[model samples]
Target: MKLVRKTIFWLHLGIGLLAGVLVLMMSVTGVLMAFERQIVEKADGFHITATGNPLGPEAHLDGLRTAKQPPSSLGFERDATRPVVYQFGKEKAVFSDPYTGKSLGNGNTAVRGFFKFILSWHRWLGREGASQATGKAIIGIGNLMFLFLLVTGVFLWFPKRWTRSGVKAITLLQKRLKGRARDWNWHNVFGFWAAIPLLVIVISGTVISQPWATTLVFHLAGETPPVQGERKKPAPFTLPESLAGLDAAFATVKSSNPDWQSIQLQLPFAKTATFIVADSHRGRPDLRRTITVDLATSGIVKSEGFDDLGPGRQTRTWIRWLHTGEAGGLPGQTIAGLAATASAVLVWTGFALSFRRFFKKRRAAA
Candidate 1:
């Protein structure tokens, strides 16, 4: 048992030292992202109250055009407790309101700004070339290292356990210890408690960051590349056939899903394209609603219930939802926020421990 602890101890210490900066970067950035909604609200002068009624995407676009500034692209998005917001580029274009048009005043986050800075530092170290790639690879590799840290931390915590006394010892914070043991104990206790959620966070995070890993996930979940369109310079807006008579399509979908909080209309970008509408109530996965209308006939071409998503698409949705804690509604989002906050604490403690050890070694050598 001592032999196992000694070997795993060195392994954990070494990797923790190697990946410390990356973990700290990720943790600090994650903490910032946790309060993203709040930051946006404060920075942009946006109100997050319920709209009670939202206009169709086309209507909103027309409204923007009336204002003499149509967005290059319009997106409908949700943040914690807010109705779907119309976004143009990086900020909220407007909240969903019935009568008057009011801009949300650019919903940028102070927290997110700091978060982005940390993320850049973490991902690129603000450098270039193969060095940038090295940063990403190191982060990816650090995720794996974290998993090891969690496991070994658990074993070390339970040197010969399965008792109330041992468990209590694990739970207690060791603030008084002065050297390697202090770092070792802190790593063991916090790492054990934080194992499951941090693992989920990191794994889901890695899947998002690594494109090839994401593609592999798609392949595993049975997703093939969607059929591609031949390259063609598309015509300027010619009263899109698909959207020409969306009144009936909108009525049909609304009639079917009366509980929807908001329905977003996505106009087709080019010839042979299809217009799309997706609805959700509180952004629940099960409530995912979509319909595609054929441009030629102005008839519904395809519709998808949330259940209809293939495993690959489902996997994609799950990872995104999981990361943001949108999978579980308000509860999930709250949990994710808490996790991010806790991760920041973990990073701080981890850094203190590692640095303390480094100083001790220096002192001993001197």
Candidate 2:
């Protein structure tokens, strides 16, 4: 039993040494992005010139005629004070006055850009293009290693006898300790408290990162995963020259969900039909619905609420919310953010302890 425990400790130490930097980077970035949408909205300054009965998508599309790529989505919140958002290809977007079609430009483009930049590093290791695949692979390994560290750290931190002194060291943090002892205590304390949420964040992330993990999630839930690219996509919808169809379609969808906080029309650059997602709260799966509208008929083609999802897809959707801690609202985000912060501390202290032991061994030999 002693030998097994010793082996687990060495494995944990070695993996930490190998992947500590990656974990540290992810942890720090995660904390930074915990309140991203709210920060961006605050930065946007909530400019409202006028609202209610705003112009249609075609007018916005015409306004953006010079854009290199057509926007994929556009929408307004129920709040007249908020600017309309036009999401272009990839990370590009423009916020504009809903009443005048005037460009708001996100109030602070730099702040928006900053979060976009951080998000790139957090998800893709700051790698782009074909190299993003390589970065993701490396990040996946780091995630696995980080997850293992949390598990093993627990075993090593558990006091064999559960004495009062052991409980004090593990639970009650000491501020005066120095050197390796201090680092050891910090690492254990942070790791112990942060384990469950870190596990949640990491495991949800792993399911997101790996296709097999995604499939396994479905399998574990006793459902077969949907085949990729198997569903036949509807033919693209061409917009009418009048563009009146779009306004009518949006109105038809809006009339049904009068209390929607925001309703975003997703074009997907399709020819005749588009999807509008109406939600009372951002990231709240329960309060959301997707409506497919036909541009030609100005009719609802289909509507799907959260309850309409299959068990497999529903669980999959929640994975994203859980990973971001939006599932439990603000309190969940607080816990997840704090856990990520602690994870950062754990990595730093673990590395410090490892290096102290390494140098101490070399000095003794000399």
Candidate 3:
């Protein structure tokens, strides 16, 4: 029993130490992303969203082909409330906007910087030349280490037996007396309560990094695979195009959802571009729902809500939401953020304890 206890403790402490630096970086950066939307809204004075009006995915593609600025790839999207949004990426340029085809400007905006930095740190540790797979592997390994730490930590905190005295010893907060026990109590108590959230976050993080996990989820949940089509050269939309006329497109879609208070239009990158719009409900900034429209045909193509996502997608989505606390909205995010912040403290204090132990062992040897 003593040997098992010591083994778990040593393993927990060693793993924590090994992954401490990376975990701290991920936690700090994760905290930044938790309030990113609110922060950008206050700083930029604008919230880029989409319209729920249905759009022709093919027409959007056609418009792009004619524009001469056709993207290498495109993705349809919508915010909490808005019209359809199109994302075009290439070797040199990446454009994001509504299907009505408004160019919001380049990708170098200040608000985008926050997202870029947080993502880079979380995924790559900001290390240049590191492949995404490598970054995810490192993060995945770290998560597994944390899971192990959680298990061992629970064992360490468990009392030797179920007697009343042992139970009191296990449950009592004697940290008030100070010294090693105090730090140990804080680490164990906080760890015990925070275990579920921490484990969830790490598990979600692993999914992000592991393709096998994603594939397994798709098979298990029986989700439809993501739509993927070929990309061709750009062909700009013809004049009289008015880039598909923003006002008419907006009015047509807005009539469908009167509950929406604001709408943002994005221009197509090419003639094939679709009219994308987005809307929000209750004034919150999450645009998990949206509608799309085809510029040429002006027909509905896709309508969906994040809440309505399929099981396969939701598994990962919910995990990400749990990680960022966005799944439950503001309250969920706040709770998760606090947990991450606590984890940072744990890492710091854990290191201090390990250091103290190391020095004590050396002193004893002398």
Q: How well does each candidate superpose onto the true structure, as a TM-score? A: 0.74, 0.89, 0.70
Best by TM-score: 2
Worst 10 residues of 1 by lDDT: 267-276
Off by over 4 Å in 2: 51-53, 56-69, 229-239, 268-273, 294-299, 364-366
What stretches of model 1 exceed 4 Å from their correct place?
47-58, 64-86, 89-97, 102-105, 108-135, 174-186, 219-244, 269-283, 294-299, 354-366
Residue 338 shift from truth in candidate 3, angstroms: 0.7
Model 3: per-residue lDDT, tens digit, 1-366? 899898887888888899888888888887777777667546544345545544534444445544655444343333442223334442233433454455444444666776876777788766546375577678778777776776677678777677986565445566464766677666666676677777777777776676676677677788865543454756543323344533344455567655555443433333232332335332233443555655556555565565666787767565555667676667877878877876776787788789879987899899
Tens-place lDDT digits, model 1, residues 1-366: 688779997887787777766677666666656545555556665455554554445564555544434443444443333433554444324454432334544345555566566656656664566687777776778776766766666666664757876665566667787655665565556666666667677778778767776888888887883443454733334333233345455555556665655555543344223323345533366666666654446566677776888888777777877776766666666666666665555666666777776786799899
Q: By summed lDDT, which 10 consecutive residues of candidate 2 come out lowest?
A: 233-242
Tens-digit lDDT track of model 2 for 1-366: 999999999999899899999999999999999988788778777647664577767677678666655566787788778777887645677788778888876468899889888888988999988898788888888888988988898889888988889888987679999988888888878878888999999999998877788999898888899886544644534433455567777777778787778888876544455555656566688788888887778778788898988788889999999998988878888999999999999989987888788898899899
* Candidate with better TM-score, 1 vs 2: 2
Model 3 is weakest, by summed lDDT over 10 consecutive residues, at: 269-278
lDDT against true structure, model 1: 0.60
lDDT of 2 at 354: 81
Judge candidate 1 at residue 335 and give its lDDT. Answer: 67
> How do all the candidates rank in terms of TM-score, highest first?
2, 1, 3
